[model samples]
Target: MIRLEGITKSFAGKEGAVAALDGIDLTIARGEIFGIIGSSGAGKSTLVRLINLLERPDGGEVFVGGERVTDARGQRLRALRRSIGMVFQHFNLLSARTVAGNVAYPLELTGAYGRNEIAVRVAALLDRVGLSEHARKYPRQLSGGQKQRVGIARALACEPAVLLCDEATSALDPQTTGAVLDLLRQINRDLGVTVALITHEMDVIRRACDRVAVLDRGRVVEEGPVTRVFLHPRHAATLRLVREAEPDGGSLDAAAASDLGGRAVRLTFTGPAAHKPILGRIARENLVDYAILAGRVGHIRETPYAQFIVSLSGRDVAGAIAGLRASGVDVELQGVAPVPEIEERACHVV
Candidate 1:
């Protein structure tokens, strides 16, 4: 339930104005986890701030929950902001306050409750975030994940219809990251809150987002369903985002660069096609030899899927290729032999 039309924001640089966001057109549906992914200076953070009018756009419109937010001022803006909650990379909690106290702070700001009312709401929030046991704990005593849980609880205190997470898991370890992501997913499902998250981590987007917008150089290069974007990324930046999502313990640039002498096609299998080992069966029945240079089998939405780049060898090259294609399998001839030159060319083009 968010729409941004021709939204542009700029800041004065030493030489001239630098466009942080340039004519951005975005629409996020209600109760959907929408993601904005980009590297540093991609205007990801600025775009998120524009949603809440934390950074008003210089040109174009900002609409949140069907209300215009670009030119909202004073009481109107303050009232509109109450329906949106934001979390940051650092768990921006009041270190001086206890876990329960921090969650109650938002309610206090709105002047909406007495002490007992605040306590009841805070207790419920602590329970919702699984921090009831640590209600009295101070920020310094909690781990990064717990601190984030506190931040999330605080954000939920206002019962905002939208939650804007700005690199919410960037500071935590992988285990903690998964926990926080799970918590956010639950928050979305249970509370029906629309979540908009901006992060450099593709894994975060992959796990949390239903749809995503790939931002590069302050422009949206691509935006669509998470599974579509992950399986068939259209842009270099989009592919980069997918690579970072899994990574296989290293950068995708190097992994993709590894020479696969034959044509390397990124075979994306989905739906019923993904569940079966069709490729393996074809190789076995046809008596063909194939070398799997680099590949992975993973799930998107718990559906079994895989991608592999294999070097095929056999006498009936065209026939064998046709056989796989005829069986409703997706295939592409990447290239042949002379691996290094082809890989170099691909890298440069991307």
Candidate 2:
């Protein structure tokens, strides 16, 4: 639903020209949640603003729904902006307006709907966001989550095909963050709205996004399906982000695996295979004694996955690996993985 090509933007810094984005190319499919993640200075916010032409790029093009919006002007620009909904991190609500009024503000600006029509639309939006009871309340009376809900409702007032979320959950607590992400997922599933999310948190992408693009130093260092990225991150930037999201920096010291004193292998298993007793059964069949040197259990979307650094003790070590591989387990024959950062979301130990 959204595409950016060879997009480059730079700003005048005290020292010189600072490149915020350079040669960025990306495509966000319809009805999917796409996340762009990077550190504080990685230009995540600037890239997002470019989508709505809030900040025009110095080079390349921005397209929405296959229409080139890079050069849109006046009424065309206004219409384009209205079609793309934006939810800010700080819940930029109109302080004086009531929840109902805040949601109706966008519709009021368009002047395309009658009073009754706008009223009905506002009511429905509030109901959809579960804020119907707080319609009469002002932004000051609402919690952070409630205010964000109002912002979401306001953004969706026009039934946009795309929703741009700029650090949408960064301001909220973890519990509230989960709740808000659930709401976004529901919105995407029910409305078929393509969502473009920007964040520095890898957890956010793991929890909600279908695909992800890892931004670093003003360039895309990594991009692909969320499951693939989480399971097997390749780029240094992507690995760093994954490690930062882990407990105790997310990896065992090489000493831990090497000290086990046998053929060490990193075993990766996912989905229903993770739940099966395949590892134990294969070990027994091959007459191997395996010790779990280190491991983690987590979910990729809804699918459960487990990665383990295991030390094998037996004559038929290769046989054990072969058996596991034949059963669809990913086997890597490295004695000591320096930084194995396979991550998980849910707490279910598979």
Best by lDDT: 2
- 1-350 per-residue lDDT for model 2 (tens digits): 89999999999999999999999999999889999999899989999999999999999999999999999999999988988999999999999899999999999999899999999999999999999999999999999999999999999999999999999999999999989999999999999989999999998999999999999989999999987887688998898898888765766666654566667787888999888899999999999988775677877668778888777878798899999999999988764457565444322121
- After superposition, the stretches of candidate 2 with alpha carbons farther than 4 Å from their true spots are 335-337, 342-350
lDDT of the candidates, in the order given:
0.80, 0.89
- Per-model TM against the reference: 0.88, 0.95
Tens digits of per-residue lDDT, candidate 1, 205-323, equal 77788999999999999999988777667788877666555434323333332343333554556668877877777777777666665555656555656665566665554665777
Every candidate's CA RMSD: 4.7, 2.3
Model 1 spans with C-alpha error above 4 angstroms: 244-263, 285-287, 315-328, 336-350
* Minimal lDDT window, size 10, model 1: 338-347
The local lDDT score (0 to 100) that residue 61 gets in candidate 2 is 96
